[model samples]
Target: MNTQEHAVGQVHRDDISSRMGMWLFLFTELMLFGGMFFLYSVYRFTNAEAFHIAAKELNTLIGCFNTAILLTSSLTMALSITALQKDKKKLSIFFQLLTIILAFGFLVNKYFEWATKFDHGIYPGSDTLLAMESGEILFFGLYYVMTGLHGLHVVIGAALIAVMTRLTAKGIINKDSFVKLESAGLYWHLVDIIWIFLFPLFYLIA
Candidate 1:
Protein backbone atom coordinates (compact mmCIF):
# COMPACT_ATOMS: atom_id res chain seq x y z
CA MET A 1 0.00 0.00 0.00
CA ASN A 2 1.03 3.59 -0.58
CA THR A 3 2.22 5.79 2.34
CA GLN A 4 -1.10 7.71 2.49
CA GLU A 5 -3.06 4.46 2.57
CA HIS A 6 -0.78 3.12 5.30
CA ALA A 7 -1.37 6.27 7.36
CA VAL A 8 -5.13 5.95 6.96
CA GLY A 9 -4.98 2.30 8.07
CA GLN A 10 -3.01 3.30 11.16
CA VAL A 11 -5.61 5.92 12.05
CA HIS A 12 -8.39 3.36 11.82
CA ARG A 13 -6.52 1.02 14.14
CA ASP A 14 -5.90 3.85 16.59
CA ASP A 15 -9.57 4.73 16.65
CA ILE A 16 -10.51 1.15 17.41
CA SER A 17 -7.89 1.01 20.14
CA SER A 18 -9.21 4.20 21.71
CA ARG A 19 -12.75 2.88 21.77
CA MET A 20 -11.69 -0.46 23.25
CA GLY A 21 -9.65 1.27 25.91
CA MET A 22 -12.56 3.51 26.86
CA TRP A 23 -14.86 0.53 27.16
CA LEU A 24 -12.39 -1.30 29.38
CA PHE A 25 -12.10 1.74 31.61
CA LEU A 26 -15.87 2.04 31.80
CA PHE A 27 -16.08 -1.64 32.82
CA THR A 28 -13.72 -1.04 35.70
CA GLU A 29 -15.84 1.92 36.83
CA LEU A 30 -18.98 -0.19 36.73
CA MET A 31 -17.32 -2.86 38.85
CA LEU A 32 -16.34 -0.28 41.42
CA PHE A 33 -19.86 1.08 41.70
CA GLY A 34 -21.39 -2.37 41.50
CA GLY A 35 -19.45 -3.54 44.53
CA MET A 36 -20.70 -0.54 46.45
CA PHE A 37 -24.24 -1.32 45.43
CA PHE A 38 -23.89 -4.88 46.71
CA LEU A 39 -22.62 -3.62 50.03
CA TYR A 40 -25.55 -1.23 50.21
CA SER A 41 -27.97 -4.08 49.57
CA VAL A 42 -26.50 -6.19 52.36
CA TYR A 43 -26.75 -3.36 54.82
CA ARG A 44 -30.24 -2.40 53.70
CA PHE A 45 -31.39 -5.97 54.11
CA THR A 46 -30.08 -6.23 57.62
CA ASN A 47 -31.14 -2.81 58.76
CA ALA A 48 -34.19 -2.11 56.77
CA GLU A 49 -35.84 0.11 59.35
CA ALA A 50 -32.80 2.27 59.95
CA PHE A 51 -32.13 2.53 56.26
CA HIS A 52 -35.70 3.55 55.65
CA ILE A 53 -35.66 6.11 58.40
CA ALA A 54 -32.34 7.58 57.29
CA ALA A 55 -33.50 7.74 53.73
CA LYS A 56 -36.44 9.84 54.80
CA GLU A 57 -34.03 12.50 55.94
CA LEU A 58 -32.89 12.96 52.39
CA ASN A 59 -34.72 15.59 50.30
CA THR A 60 -36.57 13.75 47.60
CA LEU A 61 -37.61 16.95 45.89
CA ILE A 62 -34.03 17.99 45.35
CA GLY A 63 -33.13 14.51 44.31
CA CYS A 64 -35.89 14.46 41.77
CA PHE A 65 -34.86 17.85 40.45
CA ASN A 66 -31.29 16.71 40.05
CA THR A 67 -32.47 13.60 38.30
CA ALA A 68 -34.46 15.64 35.82
CA ILE A 69 -31.51 17.87 35.23
CA LEU A 70 -29.23 14.95 34.53
CA LEU A 71 -31.73 13.24 32.29
CA THR A 72 -32.11 16.43 30.27
CA SER A 73 -28.37 16.82 30.13
CA SER A 74 -28.08 13.32 28.72
CA LEU A 75 -30.45 14.30 25.96
CA THR A 76 -28.46 17.41 25.21
CA MET A 77 -25.27 15.39 25.14
CA ALA A 78 -26.77 13.01 22.64
CA LEU A 79 -28.07 15.89 20.54
CA SER A 80 -24.62 17.41 20.60
CA ILE A 81 -23.21 14.24 19.10
CA THR A 82 -25.90 14.16 16.47
CA ALA A 83 -25.36 17.77 15.57
CA LEU A 84 -21.64 17.26 15.20
CA GLN A 85 -22.17 14.21 13.07
CA LYS A 86 -24.50 16.21 10.83
CA ASP A 87 -21.87 18.90 10.36
CA LYS A 88 -23.82 21.48 12.31
CA LYS A 89 -20.86 22.80 14.21
CA LYS A 90 -22.59 25.74 15.85
CA LEU A 91 -25.53 23.68 16.98
CA SER A 92 -23.26 21.01 18.39
CA ILE A 93 -21.34 23.59 20.39
CA PHE A 94 -24.58 25.02 21.71
CA PHE A 95 -25.73 21.61 22.91
CA GLN A 96 -22.41 20.89 24.52
CA LEU A 97 -22.52 24.16 26.43
CA LEU A 98 -26.06 23.47 27.48
CA THR A 99 -25.03 20.07 28.76
CA ILE A 100 -22.29 21.62 30.81
CA ILE A 101 -24.72 24.15 32.27
CA LEU A 102 -27.06 21.36 33.27
CA ALA A 103 -24.22 19.53 34.90
CA PHE A 104 -23.36 22.62 36.89
CA GLY A 105 -26.96 22.97 37.97
CA PHE A 106 -27.04 19.37 39.19
CA LEU A 107 -23.89 19.91 41.20
CA VAL A 108 -25.25 23.08 42.70
CA ASN A 109 -28.38 21.34 43.85
CA LYS A 110 -26.35 18.48 45.25
CA TYR A 111 -24.18 20.91 47.15
CA PHE A 112 -27.20 22.48 48.77
CA GLU A 113 -28.54 19.07 49.73
CA TRP A 114 -25.24 18.06 51.27
CA ALA A 115 -24.88 21.39 52.97
CA THR A 116 -28.29 21.04 54.60
CA LYS A 117 -27.29 17.65 55.95
CA PHE A 118 -24.11 19.09 57.34
CA ASP A 119 -25.94 22.00 58.90
CA HIS A 120 -28.13 19.51 60.71
CA GLY A 121 -25.07 17.68 62.02
CA ILE A 122 -25.58 14.62 59.88
CA TYR A 123 -22.22 14.28 58.18
CA PRO A 124 -19.68 11.52 58.63
CA GLY A 125 -17.71 11.37 61.90
CA SER A 126 -19.83 14.10 63.49
CA ASP A 127 -20.83 13.87 67.13
CA THR A 128 -24.52 13.95 66.29
CA LEU A 129 -24.17 11.15 63.79
CA LEU A 130 -22.04 9.14 66.17
CA ALA A 131 -24.73 9.39 68.81
CA MET A 132 -27.20 7.65 66.51
CA GLU A 133 -27.92 3.90 66.59
CA SER A 134 -25.58 1.50 64.85
CA GLY A 135 -27.94 0.81 61.98
CA GLU A 136 -28.71 4.46 61.54
CA ILE A 137 -25.04 5.26 61.64
CA LEU A 138 -24.35 2.65 59.03
CA PHE A 139 -27.11 4.07 56.89
CA PHE A 140 -25.64 7.54 56.97
CA GLY A 141 -22.18 6.13 56.39
CA LEU A 142 -23.25 4.41 53.22
CA TYR A 143 -25.30 7.40 52.19
CA TYR A 144 -22.35 9.74 52.43
CA VAL A 145 -19.88 7.39 50.84
CA MET A 146 -22.04 6.30 47.96
CA THR A 147 -23.48 9.68 47.11
CA GLY A 148 -20.14 11.40 47.57
CA LEU A 149 -18.47 8.98 45.21
CA HIS A 150 -21.19 9.49 42.66
CA GLY A 151 -20.85 13.24 42.98
CA LEU A 152 -17.16 12.93 42.30
CA HIS A 153 -17.93 11.06 39.14
CA VAL A 154 -20.30 13.84 38.10
CA VAL A 155 -17.54 16.38 38.56
CA ILE A 156 -15.13 14.33 36.48
CA GLY A 157 -17.70 13.81 33.75
CA ALA A 158 -18.44 17.53 33.60
CA ALA A 159 -14.76 18.28 33.33
CA LEU A 160 -14.42 15.87 30.45
CA ILE A 161 -17.38 17.43 28.69
CA ALA A 162 -15.93 20.85 29.20
CA VAL A 163 -12.77 19.70 27.51
CA MET A 164 -14.79 18.25 24.68
CA THR A 165 -16.71 21.50 24.36
CA ARG A 166 -13.48 23.41 24.00
CA LEU A 167 -12.20 20.97 21.45
CA THR A 168 -15.44 21.10 19.50
CA ALA A 169 -15.35 24.87 19.48
CA LYS A 170 -11.83 24.72 18.14
CA GLY A 171 -12.95 22.39 15.32
CA ILE A 172 -10.72 19.66 16.68
CA ILE A 173 -13.78 17.54 17.45
CA ASN A 174 -15.86 18.03 14.33
CA LYS A 175 -17.94 15.91 11.98
CA ASP A 176 -14.88 14.12 10.68
CA SER A 177 -13.26 13.53 14.10
CA PHE A 178 -15.59 13.21 17.08
CA VAL A 179 -14.65 10.05 18.89
CA LYS A 180 -13.53 12.04 21.90
CA LEU A 181 -16.89 13.81 22.10
CA GLU A 182 -18.71 10.50 21.78
CA SER A 183 -16.65 9.04 24.58
CA ALA A 184 -17.45 12.03 26.75
CA GLY A 185 -21.13 11.59 26.02
CA LEU A 186 -20.91 7.93 27.01
CA TYR A 187 -19.34 8.88 30.32
CA TRP A 188 -21.93 11.57 30.99
CA HIS A 189 -24.70 9.09 30.30
CA LEU A 190 -23.17 6.61 32.70
CA VAL A 191 -23.11 9.26 35.38
CA ASP A 192 -26.78 9.95 34.76
CA ILE A 193 -27.71 6.25 34.88
CA ILE A 194 -25.90 5.79 38.15
CA TRP A 195 -27.86 8.70 39.60
CA ILE A 196 -31.13 7.16 38.45
CA PHE A 197 -30.33 4.18 40.66
CA LEU A 198 -29.07 6.35 43.47
CA PHE A 199 -32.09 8.63 43.57
CA PRO A 200 -34.54 5.82 44.21
CA LEU A 201 -32.24 3.99 46.57
CA PHE A 202 -31.52 6.98 48.75
CA TYR A 203 -34.37 9.40 48.24
CA LEU A 204 -37.42 7.25 47.52
CA ILE A 205 -36.64 4.33 49.79
CA ALA A 206 -38.39 6.03 52.62
Candidate 2:
Protein backbone atom coordinates (compact mmCIF):
# COMPACT_ATOMS: atom_id res chain seq x y z
CA MET A 1 0.00 0.00 0.00
CA ASN A 2 2.87 2.31 0.76
CA THR A 3 4.56 1.41 -2.54
CA GLN A 4 6.94 -0.77 -0.58
CA GLU A 5 4.79 -3.32 1.13
CA HIS A 6 4.55 -5.75 -1.75
CA ALA A 7 4.11 -9.44 -1.10
CA VAL A 8 3.47 -12.69 -2.96
CA GLY A 9 4.24 -10.78 -6.18
CA GLN A 10 2.35 -7.50 -5.91
CA VAL A 11 5.37 -5.46 -7.07
CA HIS A 12 6.10 -3.44 -3.95
CA ARG A 13 7.23 -1.01 -6.60
CA ASP A 14 10.63 -2.72 -6.21
CA ASP A 15 12.12 -6.15 -5.57
CA ILE A 16 11.37 -9.61 -6.93
CA SER A 17 7.77 -9.38 -5.89
CA SER A 18 7.34 -6.33 -8.03
CA ARG A 19 8.87 -8.03 -11.06
CA MET A 20 6.56 -10.98 -10.58
CA GLY A 21 3.61 -8.70 -10.32
CA MET A 22 4.75 -6.90 -13.43
CA TRP A 23 4.84 -10.17 -15.31
CA LEU A 24 1.39 -11.01 -14.00
CA PHE A 25 0.00 -7.67 -15.11
CA LEU A 26 1.70 -8.06 -18.46
CA PHE A 27 0.05 -11.44 -18.92
CA THR A 28 -3.32 -9.82 -18.48
CA GLU A 29 -2.43 -7.09 -20.94
CA LEU A 30 -1.39 -9.79 -23.39
CA MET A 31 -4.77 -11.42 -23.03
CA LEU A 32 -6.46 -8.11 -23.67
CA PHE A 33 -4.47 -7.55 -26.84
CA GLY A 34 -5.07 -11.14 -27.83
CA GLY A 35 -8.80 -10.56 -27.79
CA MET A 36 -8.40 -7.49 -29.96
CA PHE A 37 -6.31 -9.47 -32.41
CA PHE A 38 -9.02 -12.08 -32.51
CA LEU A 39 -11.54 -9.39 -33.33
CA TYR A 40 -9.25 -8.17 -36.07
CA SER A 41 -9.08 -11.63 -37.58
CA VAL A 42 -12.85 -11.91 -37.54
CA TYR A 43 -13.43 -8.54 -39.15
CA ARG A 44 -10.67 -8.93 -41.71
CA PHE A 45 -12.22 -12.19 -42.75
CA THR A 46 -15.58 -10.50 -43.10
CA ASN A 47 -14.37 -7.21 -44.62
CA ALA A 48 -11.28 -8.12 -46.55
CA GLU A 49 -11.75 -5.27 -48.99
CA ALA A 50 -12.17 -2.59 -46.35
CA PHE A 51 -9.33 -3.91 -44.28
CA HIS A 52 -7.00 -3.94 -47.25
CA ILE A 53 -8.08 -0.48 -48.31
CA ALA A 54 -7.74 0.91 -44.84
CA ALA A 55 -4.38 -0.71 -44.45
CA LYS A 56 -3.15 0.98 -47.56
CA GLU A 57 -4.25 4.34 -46.22
CA LEU A 58 -1.73 4.02 -43.39
CA ASN A 59 1.79 5.36 -43.83
CA THR A 60 3.89 2.23 -43.78
CA LEU A 61 7.25 3.98 -43.75
CA ILE A 62 6.34 6.04 -40.74
CA GLY A 63 5.03 2.99 -38.96
CA CYS A 64 8.31 1.23 -39.60
CA PHE A 65 10.24 4.21 -38.32
CA ASN A 66 8.25 4.26 -35.11
CA THR A 67 8.71 0.57 -34.70
CA ALA A 68 12.45 0.96 -34.84
CA ILE A 69 12.29 3.89 -32.45
CA LEU A 70 10.29 1.93 -29.90
CA LEU A 71 12.58 -1.05 -30.21
CA THR A 72 15.54 1.20 -29.52
CA SER A 73 13.80 2.68 -26.51
CA SER A 74 13.13 -0.79 -25.24
CA LEU A 75 16.85 -1.41 -25.41
CA THR A 76 17.59 1.74 -23.47
CA MET A 77 15.00 0.87 -20.86
CA ALA A 78 16.58 -2.52 -20.37
CA LEU A 79 20.01 -0.97 -20.09
CA SER A 80 18.69 1.45 -17.51
CA ILE A 81 17.38 -1.34 -15.37
CA THR A 82 20.62 -3.22 -15.71
CA ALA A 83 22.56 -0.12 -14.75
CA LEU A 84 20.34 0.39 -11.75
CA GLN A 85 20.93 -3.16 -10.69
CA LYS A 86 24.68 -2.64 -11.04
CA ASP A 87 24.36 0.47 -8.83
CA LYS A 88 25.10 2.82 -11.67
CA LYS A 89 22.75 5.66 -10.86
CA LYS A 90 24.02 8.28 -13.26
CA LEU A 91 24.10 5.91 -16.21
CA SER A 92 20.68 4.61 -15.31
CA ILE A 93 19.23 8.09 -15.31
CA PHE A 94 20.89 8.84 -18.62
CA PHE A 95 19.37 5.78 -20.27
CA GLN A 96 16.04 6.57 -18.69
CA LEU A 97 16.08 10.05 -20.18
CA LEU A 98 16.97 8.63 -23.56
CA THR A 99 14.10 6.20 -23.35
CA ILE A 100 11.77 9.04 -22.42
CA ILE A 101 12.83 11.12 -25.39
CA LEU A 102 12.33 8.23 -27.78
CA ALA A 103 8.92 7.51 -26.33
CA PHE A 104 7.93 11.15 -26.74
CA GLY A 105 9.07 11.08 -30.34
CA PHE A 106 6.98 7.99 -30.98
CA LEU A 107 3.88 9.69 -29.59
CA VAL A 108 4.50 12.93 -31.47
CA ASN A 109 4.84 11.09 -34.75
CA LYS A 110 1.68 9.18 -34.01
CA TYR A 111 -0.16 12.40 -33.24
CA PHE A 112 0.83 13.94 -36.54
CA GLU A 113 -0.03 10.82 -38.52
CA TRP A 114 -3.41 10.54 -36.87
CA ALA A 115 -4.05 14.26 -37.27
CA THR A 116 -3.30 14.04 -40.96
CA LYS A 117 -5.76 11.20 -41.28
CA PHE A 118 -8.43 13.31 -39.61
CA ASP A 119 -7.72 16.17 -41.96
CA HIS A 120 -8.28 13.80 -44.87
CA GLY A 121 -11.73 12.86 -43.58
CA ILE A 122 -10.87 9.76 -41.63
CA TYR A 123 -11.76 9.27 -37.99
CA PRO A 124 -13.81 7.16 -35.66
CA GLY A 125 -17.05 8.79 -36.63
CA SER A 126 -18.42 11.81 -38.52
CA ASP A 127 -17.96 12.55 -42.22
CA THR A 128 -15.53 9.76 -42.81
CA LEU A 129 -17.77 7.46 -40.85
CA LEU A 130 -20.66 8.59 -42.97
CA ALA A 131 -18.69 8.13 -46.16
CA MET A 132 -17.82 4.54 -45.38
CA GLU A 133 -20.12 1.70 -46.37
CA SER A 134 -21.18 -0.63 -43.56
CA GLY A 135 -18.17 -2.95 -43.74
CA GLU A 136 -15.75 -0.12 -44.29
CA ILE A 137 -17.32 1.76 -41.45
CA LEU A 138 -16.86 -1.29 -39.31
CA PHE A 139 -13.21 -1.44 -40.36
CA PHE A 140 -12.50 2.07 -39.16
CA GLY A 141 -14.58 1.35 -36.11
CA LEU A 142 -12.19 -1.40 -35.02
CA TYR A 143 -9.23 0.69 -36.07
CA TYR A 144 -10.25 3.58 -33.88
CA VAL A 145 -11.13 1.42 -30.92
CA MET A 146 -7.92 -0.59 -31.05
CA THR A 147 -5.54 2.25 -31.75
CA GLY A 148 -7.30 4.52 -29.31
CA LEU A 149 -6.84 2.00 -26.54
CA HIS A 150 -3.20 1.52 -27.50
CA GLY A 151 -2.70 5.28 -27.43
CA LEU A 152 -4.12 5.35 -23.93
CA HIS A 153 -1.51 2.79 -22.94
CA VAL A 154 1.18 4.98 -24.46
CA VAL A 155 0.07 7.89 -22.33
CA ILE A 156 0.03 5.69 -19.28
CA GLY A 157 3.51 4.36 -20.08
CA ALA A 158 4.84 7.90 -20.44
CA ALA A 159 3.35 8.83 -17.10
CA LEU A 160 5.02 5.82 -15.53
CA ILE A 161 8.34 6.82 -17.01
CA ALA A 162 7.93 10.34 -15.70
CA VAL A 163 7.37 8.92 -12.27
CA MET A 164 10.39 6.66 -12.59
CA THR A 165 12.49 9.56 -13.78
CA ARG A 166 11.54 11.53 -10.74
CA LEU A 167 12.18 8.68 -8.39
CA THR A 168 15.56 7.95 -9.90
CA ALA A 169 16.56 11.60 -9.89
CA LYS A 170 15.57 11.95 -6.27
CA GLY A 171 17.82 9.01 -5.44
CA ILE A 172 14.85 6.95 -4.33
CA ILE A 173 15.93 3.97 -6.44
CA ASN A 174 19.08 2.19 -5.42
CA LYS A 175 20.73 -1.17 -5.90
CA ASP A 176 18.09 -2.11 -3.42
CA SER A 177 15.91 0.64 -4.81
CA PHE A 178 12.28 0.00 -3.97
CA VAL A 179 11.20 1.27 -7.34
CA LYS A 180 9.36 -0.69 -9.99
CA LEU A 181 11.80 0.13 -12.74
CA GLU A 182 11.83 -3.42 -14.03
CA SER A 183 8.08 -3.55 -14.00
CA ALA A 184 8.18 -0.25 -15.76
CA GLY A 185 10.44 -1.89 -18.27
CA LEU A 186 8.02 -4.77 -18.59
CA TYR A 187 5.13 -2.44 -19.31
CA TRP A 188 7.26 -0.47 -21.72
CA HIS A 189 8.18 -3.61 -23.62
CA LEU A 190 4.54 -4.60 -23.78
CA VAL A 191 3.68 -1.23 -25.29
CA ASP A 192 6.40 -1.64 -27.87
CA ILE A 193 5.35 -5.19 -28.65
CA ILE A 194 1.76 -4.14 -29.17
CA TRP A 195 2.81 -1.49 -31.64
CA ILE A 196 5.06 -3.92 -33.47
CA PHE A 197 2.07 -6.05 -34.44
CA LEU A 198 -0.38 -3.20 -34.73
CA PHE A 199 1.89 -1.47 -37.21
CA PRO A 200 1.82 -4.41 -39.57
CA LEU A 201 -1.86 -5.08 -39.13
CA PHE A 202 -2.95 -1.49 -39.47
CA TYR A 203 -0.46 -0.34 -42.04
CA LEU A 204 0.82 -3.25 -44.13
CA ILE A 205 -1.77 -6.00 -44.26
CA ALA A 206 -1.26 -6.70 -47.93
Candidate 3:
Protein backbone atom coordinates (compact mmCIF):
# COMPACT_ATOMS: atom_id res chain seq x y z
CA MET A 1 0.00 0.00 0.00
CA ASN A 2 1.07 3.57 -0.66
CA THR A 3 2.23 5.81 2.21
CA GLN A 4 -0.77 8.09 1.60
CA GLU A 5 -3.16 5.13 1.95
CA HIS A 6 -1.46 4.06 5.21
CA ALA A 7 -1.75 7.60 6.58
CA VAL A 8 -5.46 7.71 5.82
CA GLY A 9 -5.93 4.34 7.52
CA GLN A 10 -4.13 5.60 10.60
CA VAL A 11 -6.31 8.70 10.80
CA HIS A 12 -9.45 6.59 10.58
CA ARG A 13 -8.20 4.45 13.45
CA ASP A 14 -7.46 7.56 15.45
CA ASP A 15 -11.01 8.77 14.97
CA ILE A 16 -12.33 5.45 16.18
CA SER A 17 -10.07 5.65 19.22
CA SER A 18 -11.29 9.12 20.06
CA ARG A 19 -14.94 8.07 19.86
CA MET A 20 -14.32 5.02 22.02
CA GLY A 21 -12.69 7.13 24.69
CA MET A 22 -15.70 9.43 24.84
CA TRP A 23 -18.08 6.51 25.09
CA LEU A 24 -16.07 5.07 27.98
CA PHE A 25 -16.23 8.37 29.78
CA LEU A 26 -19.99 8.51 29.27
CA PHE A 27 -20.36 4.99 30.62
CA THR A 28 -18.60 5.97 33.81
CA GLU A 29 -20.89 8.95 34.15
CA LEU A 30 -23.94 6.77 33.72
CA MET A 31 -22.69 4.47 36.46
CA LEU A 32 -22.21 7.36 38.83
CA PHE A 33 -25.73 8.68 38.34
CA GLY A 34 -27.20 5.22 38.34
CA GLY A 35 -26.12 4.74 41.93
CA MET A 36 -27.73 7.99 42.92
CA PHE A 37 -30.97 7.04 41.23
CA PHE A 38 -31.02 3.73 43.02
CA LEU A 39 -30.72 5.45 46.34
CA TYR A 40 -33.43 7.92 45.41
CA SER A 41 -35.75 5.13 44.44
CA VAL A 42 -35.28 3.28 47.68
CA TYR A 43 -35.89 6.42 49.69
CA ARG A 44 -38.97 7.26 47.71
CA PHE A 45 -40.35 3.81 48.22
CA THR A 46 -39.81 3.99 51.94
CA ASN A 47 -41.17 7.51 52.35
CA ALA A 48 -43.91 7.57 49.79
CA GLU A 49 -46.16 10.15 51.46
CA ALA A 50 -43.44 12.57 52.49
CA PHE A 51 -41.76 12.33 49.14
CA HIS A 52 -44.99 13.18 47.39
CA ILE A 53 -45.54 16.17 49.65
CA ALA A 54 -42.03 17.41 49.03
CA ALA A 55 -42.37 16.97 45.30
CA LYS A 56 -45.55 19.03 45.30
CA GLU A 57 -43.53 22.03 46.45
CA LEU A 58 -41.58 22.00 43.17
CA ASN A 59 -42.77 24.10 40.24
CA THR A 60 -43.93 21.74 37.55
CA LEU A 61 -44.38 24.51 35.02
CA ILE A 62 -40.78 25.56 35.25
CA GLY A 63 -39.61 21.99 35.10
CA CYS A 64 -41.67 21.34 32.02
CA PHE A 65 -40.47 24.53 30.37
CA ASN A 66 -36.86 23.60 30.98
CA THR A 67 -37.64 20.16 29.63
CA ALA A 68 -38.88 21.69 26.42
CA ILE A 69 -35.84 23.89 26.16
CA LEU A 70 -33.44 21.03 26.64
CA LEU A 71 -35.30 18.91 24.12
CA THR A 72 -35.00 21.69 21.60
CA SER A 73 -31.36 22.09 22.38
CA SER A 74 -30.88 18.41 21.68
CA LEU A 75 -32.47 18.94 18.30
CA THR A 76 -30.19 21.85 17.56
CA MET A 77 -27.20 19.86 18.69
CA ALA A 78 -28.13 17.12 16.25
CA LEU A 79 -28.61 19.71 13.53
CA SER A 80 -25.14 21.03 14.23
CA ILE A 81 -23.75 17.57 13.65
CA THR A 82 -25.64 17.20 10.42
CA ALA A 83 -24.60 20.63 9.20
CA LEU A 84 -20.98 19.90 9.84
CA GLN A 85 -21.31 16.57 8.06
CA LYS A 86 -22.79 18.34 5.07
CA ASP A 87 -19.91 20.83 5.09
CA LYS A 88 -22.19 23.74 5.90
CA LYS A 89 -19.95 25.51 8.34
CA LYS A 90 -22.17 28.53 8.87
CA LEU A 91 -25.23 26.45 9.65
CA SER A 92 -23.24 24.29 12.02
CA ILE A 93 -21.98 27.30 13.93
CA PHE A 94 -25.45 28.83 14.08
CA PHE A 95 -26.92 25.69 15.57
CA GLN A 96 -24.12 25.45 18.12
CA LEU A 97 -24.77 29.00 19.23
CA LEU A 98 -28.48 28.31 19.57
CA THR A 99 -27.71 25.29 21.71
CA ILE A 100 -25.58 27.44 23.99
CA ILE A 101 -28.35 30.02 24.35
CA LEU A 102 -30.88 27.34 25.21
CA ALA A 103 -28.49 25.92 27.80
CA PHE A 104 -28.13 29.33 29.38
CA GLY A 105 -31.89 29.74 29.43
CA PHE A 106 -32.18 26.46 31.29
CA LEU A 107 -29.70 27.66 33.90
CA VAL A 108 -31.60 30.90 34.34
CA ASN A 109 -34.80 29.01 34.96
CA LYS A 110 -32.99 26.77 37.43
CA TYR A 111 -31.75 29.76 39.36
CA PHE A 112 -35.27 31.10 39.73
CA GLU A 113 -36.56 27.74 40.83
CA TRP A 114 -33.91 27.39 43.50
CA ALA A 115 -34.44 30.97 44.56
CA THR A 116 -38.13 30.36 45.02
CA LYS A 117 -37.38 27.32 47.15
CA PHE A 118 -34.97 29.28 49.23
CA ASP A 119 -37.45 32.07 49.70
CA HIS A 120 -39.86 29.52 51.11
CA GLY A 121 -37.16 28.36 53.50
CA ILE A 122 -37.05 24.92 51.97
CA TYR A 123 -33.36 24.53 51.33
CA PRO A 124 -31.33 21.68 52.75
CA GLY A 125 -30.56 22.16 56.44
CA SER A 126 -32.81 25.24 56.57
CA ASP A 127 -34.78 25.63 59.78
CA THR A 128 -38.03 25.19 57.88
CA LEU A 129 -36.85 22.04 56.22
CA LEU A 130 -35.53 20.69 59.49
CA ALA A 131 -38.93 21.22 61.03
CA MET A 132 -40.53 19.08 58.34
CA GLU A 133 -41.03 15.32 58.47
CA SER A 134 -37.89 13.27 58.21
CA GLY A 135 -39.03 11.76 54.93
CA GLU A 136 -39.73 15.16 53.39
CA ILE A 137 -36.29 16.38 54.44
CA LEU A 138 -34.69 13.37 52.84
CA PHE A 139 -36.59 14.03 49.64
CA PHE A 140 -35.47 17.65 49.46
CA GLY A 141 -31.91 16.74 50.28
CA LEU A 142 -31.79 14.26 47.41
CA TYR A 143 -33.53 16.74 45.19
CA TYR A 144 -30.95 19.44 45.80
CA VAL A 145 -27.91 17.20 45.52
CA MET A 146 -29.08 15.40 42.38
CA THR A 147 -30.25 18.50 40.60
CA GLY A 148 -27.16 20.44 41.62
CA LEU A 149 -24.94 17.76 40.11
CA HIS A 150 -26.98 17.76 36.94
CA GLY A 151 -26.72 21.53 36.73
CA LEU A 152 -22.97 21.27 37.03
CA HIS A 153 -23.02 18.88 34.10
CA VAL A 154 -25.09 21.36 32.13
CA VAL A 155 -22.55 24.09 32.78
CA ILE A 156 -19.71 21.85 31.69
CA GLY A 157 -21.56 20.83 28.55
CA ALA A 158 -22.28 24.44 27.66
CA ALA A 159 -18.65 25.37 28.12
CA LEU A 160 -17.57 22.48 25.92
CA ILE A 161 -20.01 23.55 23.23
CA ALA A 162 -18.75 27.10 23.44
CA VAL A 163 -15.24 25.87 22.83
CA MET A 164 -16.47 23.74 19.97
CA THR A 165 -18.19 26.75 18.47
CA ARG A 166 -14.94 28.69 18.53
CA LEU A 167 -13.05 25.81 17.03
CA THR A 168 -15.58 25.51 14.25
CA ALA A 169 -15.28 29.23 13.47
CA LYS A 170 -11.50 28.99 13.29
CA GLY A 171 -11.63 26.10 10.81
CA ILE A 172 -10.13 23.72 13.34
CA ILE A 173 -13.27 21.62 13.58
CA ASN A 174 -14.67 21.16 10.11
CA LYS A 175 -16.03 18.29 8.08
CA ASP A 176 -12.89 16.24 8.40
CA SER A 177 -12.34 16.72 12.14
CA PHE A 178 -15.69 17.62 13.61
CA VAL A 179 -15.50 14.80 16.07
CA LYS A 180 -15.00 17.27 18.91
CA LEU A 181 -18.30 18.89 18.04
CA GLU A 182 -19.95 15.50 17.92
CA SER A 183 -18.54 14.65 21.34
CA ALA A 184 -19.95 17.84 22.77
CA GLY A 185 -23.32 17.04 21.27
CA LEU A 186 -23.28 13.61 22.82
CA TYR A 187 -22.48 15.10 26.22
CA TRP A 188 -25.24 17.67 25.88
CA HIS A 189 -27.70 14.96 25.02
CA LEU A 190 -26.65 13.06 28.12
CA VAL A 191 -27.32 16.13 30.21
CA ASP A 192 -30.75 16.46 28.66
CA ILE A 193 -31.53 12.82 29.32
CA ILE A 194 -30.71 13.19 32.99
CA TRP A 195 -32.99 16.20 33.26
CA ILE A 196 -35.78 14.27 31.60
CA PHE A 197 -35.78 11.80 34.47
CA LEU A 198 -35.24 14.51 37.06
CA PHE A 199 -38.18 16.61 35.89
CA PRO A 200 -40.67 13.84 36.31
CA LEU A 201 -39.20 12.42 39.47
CA PHE A 202 -38.91 15.73 41.29
CA TYR A 203 -41.79 17.74 39.81
CA LEU A 204 -44.53 15.39 38.64
CA ILE A 205 -44.22 12.35 40.88
CA ALA A 206 -46.47 13.99 43.39
Instruction: Report the number of the highest-TM-score candidate.
Output: 3
Candidate 2 TM-score over all chains jointly = 0.88
Ranking by lDDT: 3, 1, 2
lDDT string for model 2 (57-118, tens) is 77888888989999999999999999998989889999988998998998898888889888
TM-score of each: 0.93, 0.88, 0.94
Q: Distance (Å) between predicted and true CA of 190, model 2?
A: 0.6
Off by over 4 Å in 2: 1-14
Model 3 TM-score relative to the real fold: 0.94
The per-prediction CA RMSD against the true structure, in angstroms, equals 3.2, 4.5, 3.1
Give lDDT tens digits, candidate 3, residues 82-192: 999999999999999999999999999999999999999999879999999999999999999999999999999999999999999999999998888888888999999
**Pairs of residues at least 3 apart in sequence or in different chains that clash in candidate 1:** none
The digit string of per-residue lDDT tens for model 1 on 37-155 reads: 99999999999998888888999899989999999999999999999999999999999899989999998998999999999999889999999887889988888898899999989
lDDT of each: 0.90, 0.84, 0.92
